[model samples]
Target: MKIAVYGASGYQGKLVLTELARRDIETVLAGRNRARLEEAASAIGLPDAERRSADASDHEALVSAFRGCDAVINCAGPFTSSGEAVVRAAIAAGCHYVDTSGEQLYVKKIFDTFTTEAENAGVTVVPAANDGCVPVDLMAHILADRLEPVEEIITTHVVVGGGGMSRGSLRSVVETIDAIKAGGLAYTDGDWHPGVPARRTAITLPGQSEATPVMAFPVPEVVTIPRHIRVRRVQGLTEAALGDRLNTPLTPEIIESLPEGPDGDGRRTQHFTYVLDATGIDGRRARGIVQGPDTYGTTAVIAVEGARRLIAEPAKPGVLAPAQAYPSTAFLDFLVPHGIQWIIEDAPAT
Candidate 1:
């Protein structure tokens, strides 16, 4: 099936285009710059792929660019600002949409604002379709089932050996400073709580003996996991050092000074582990961990796969969490060949 890659001139967009090519899927490159889209396409040997340059402000152009495409994989960010227009245009074009957005509030906005519109238009929109959200959300569903009568779910992740952050990624970091500063929104007792304290101070990463000290980190699972899973609480955690790093004030100037993105070797050497800890009302507990490769690369894979599923298998049309849109086990199995391994088992409720 044919798909459109909005922001195809950017880091994650280029990665998504590469993955689509690897799968032999036809794709149209789209962004605000035709020349850059052309360069990105030619760099990947897709010189003839359709190129559509549409600034996010121009609604009709985006719709035209996405028209005739089965789905659109959006890699644009600071999605907090530039995302809604693309989402609107994709749905208006009758194309299902998936965006690599990790901004907690943006996901909440997409859910709150587009659910009814997407449902009426019979279009699916899955935001935060990235490494962090997809795997953790999927595993949360998996573990919650095993930890039935689940009352709480805590998600944490660790990444090692990353090349560097992309300019867009860094800019997104600045744009989403509010969520990052607040450690993200938390779901508790059937309501969302803001500026919550770090409920747990430390969590053990898989393959490590000692518990790593952590701080509340913004992860969209705090927003998406509760959509399908019956749970009272959800929160995200990451290493303390990283939290301190993000706590620094980041501005456009700082982001502009960074490299465009990680080169192939930089991406290949990176690895990550996402862990989901679930607590049931009965005091039974379970944990699931997903170990995978490069953060950006894996995010591209997740976004493309999610879009492919949205078009081919088709979930009930509307905004959906990764797990709500498809079978968590099936999706997890799909990741196996991509260098992702995961499992869920009983854990002591201590």
Candidate 2:
């Protein structure tokens, strides 16, 4: 299948291009920078794939760039500003669309505004195709489905040993500072509530000695899971330190000085552990944990994989969450061999 990667020269974009090549899929390296797109194509040894310059702000240019491609994977962010335009272009071109946007507000917009348009165009629009929340969203489905009659889901993410955010990731955080400062978000009683702070609590990790302090934070999963599961409450948690850093505002100078791309060695050394606990009204509980590579690598692999599956077996057209857009276990299983380690456990009512 032929896929076009907008923002092809950026950090996550490069990784997406690499994985697409490994799968033997044809690709188009696309962005506003012609030289950089060509350079990226050459670096990935995909000299034959198309390289085109198209700015996200130019609708016609994006439509032109996306034409003739089966799918388009957008790696550019602060998606609040750029994501909808790309989605519109993809729909206009009748191409399936996916993006690595973990921004909750943007993600909600995709589902709210584009679901019908994408369905009419016979293509799926999937957002949050990243470590930010897709895996956790899928796991929520797996565990909730297994337990049956799920009531509440509490998910915690630990950056294994901690790591630095990629420049693009930092930019995403900076772009959404207002939302972060309002505090973490959660879903309860069919409405989203903001101004929720990360509640400090101790939890045991897979191979850890003592319980570690983790604080609740907002995640896109809180928005995506309800599309499939009927849970009444969903809450996200991450390490307190990282959560604090993520909510911290960035100055214009600080944003300008951030590295333009991910450090290869630095990314490899970074790993993550995500744990989800589900409780039923009957007092039964289930827990699951997923460990994987850093955010950029994980997002790249999953986005490419999602594209591959969408091409091979298309989802019923619409804007859907990662889990809703694909077979839950099948999609989750696809990540296992790619270095996603997971374990799910069940317990009787307490």
Candidate 3:
């Protein structure tokens, strides 16, 4: 099946192309820059892949680019700016949609604004199709589904790798801070509520004795988890170092001054672990841990696999989350060979 990847010249887009090539699926490398798209396609050994120049701001051009493709994977980030346009284009072009967006605002906007239209058009729009919240969302679904009437859930994660920030990641942070300023938000008592400033907590990583610092940070899980599970509350936390960096204030000028793109240490192997703890209203709790390759690589895997599923068997037409779009266990297991693994340990009620 043929697919299109927007922002094909960007970092995430490059990884997605690599994964699609591994799966032997035809793809269209599309973006605003013709030169970069050609360079990226050749660098990735996809010289024969189709190339289309489509600016995110030009809805007509984007629609033209998406037309006739089975699916479109949007690798562009800071979705607050370009996400809506791409989704509109995909819907207009009658193609399934997937994206690596981690912004809660964008997810909310997508669900709130596009669900009905996408449903009417027989299109599937899956947002946050990445490690940012897919793992946490799936873990929450697995644990909560096992024990009904779950009261709360807390997801904590730590990234252990040598790669520095990419341009897209840096821009995503800038946009997140701007969204947070517009209005603080989180889940409470099974509802969206005003968010509180995040604080740090010390937790020991599985199989490690030393306690690492973490802090409650905003993630897409806060918006997606409630869509399926009847949880009273949900929050996501990240390593203290990353948390502090995200919390720092940055002006548009300052953001423009930061590194323009990410440079990975070729030799370093990056990985991450996400621990999800769920509590039942009856006072019982369950914990699940997921480990996977570096964030960018895992994101590519998720997006490509998700697209494969969509093309193989079209999902129910509507805006869906990663966990909701596919079977939880099967989908998670599909990535095991690609460095994704998980284990759940449940404790008896006290």
Against the unseen true structure, what C-alpha lDDT does each candidate score? Answer: 0.88, 0.82, 0.82
lDDT of 1 by residue, 1-350 (tens): 99999999888999999999999999999998888998899888898799999999999999999999999999988799989999999999999999999888888989999999999999999999998889889888888877766788888867456687788888887877777877888888887888889878988878789988988878888989889888888988888878667667777777777779888888887888888889998898998888887889899889999999999999999999999897999998998899999988788775
Error at 54, model 3, angstroms: 1.5
Give the per-residue lDDT of model 2 (tens digit) for 221-255: 88898788888878777766666676466876887
TM-score ranking from best candidate downward: 1, 2, 3
Q: What overall lDDT, based on C-alpha atoms, would model 1 receive against the true structure? A: 0.88
Output the TM-score of candidate 2.
0.93
Model 3 lDDT tens row, 1-350:
99999999988899899999998999999999999999999889998889999888899999999999999999988788999999999999999999998787788889999999999999999988987578778878999887668877777767656556567877886767755443335688757765554533776778889988876666787888888998887777667776455567767777668664444553135677888878899988888999876778888989998988987977789998777788888888887887888888886674
What stretches of model 3 exceed 4 Å from their correct place? 178-184, 197-200, 208-213, 247-268, 348-350
Which scores better on lDDT, 1 or 3? 1
Residue 245 CA displacement from its true place in model 2, Å? 2.8
Per-candidate TM equals 0.97, 0.93, 0.91
Worst 10 residues of 2 by lDDT: 240-249
RMSD of each: 1.3, 2.0, 2.6
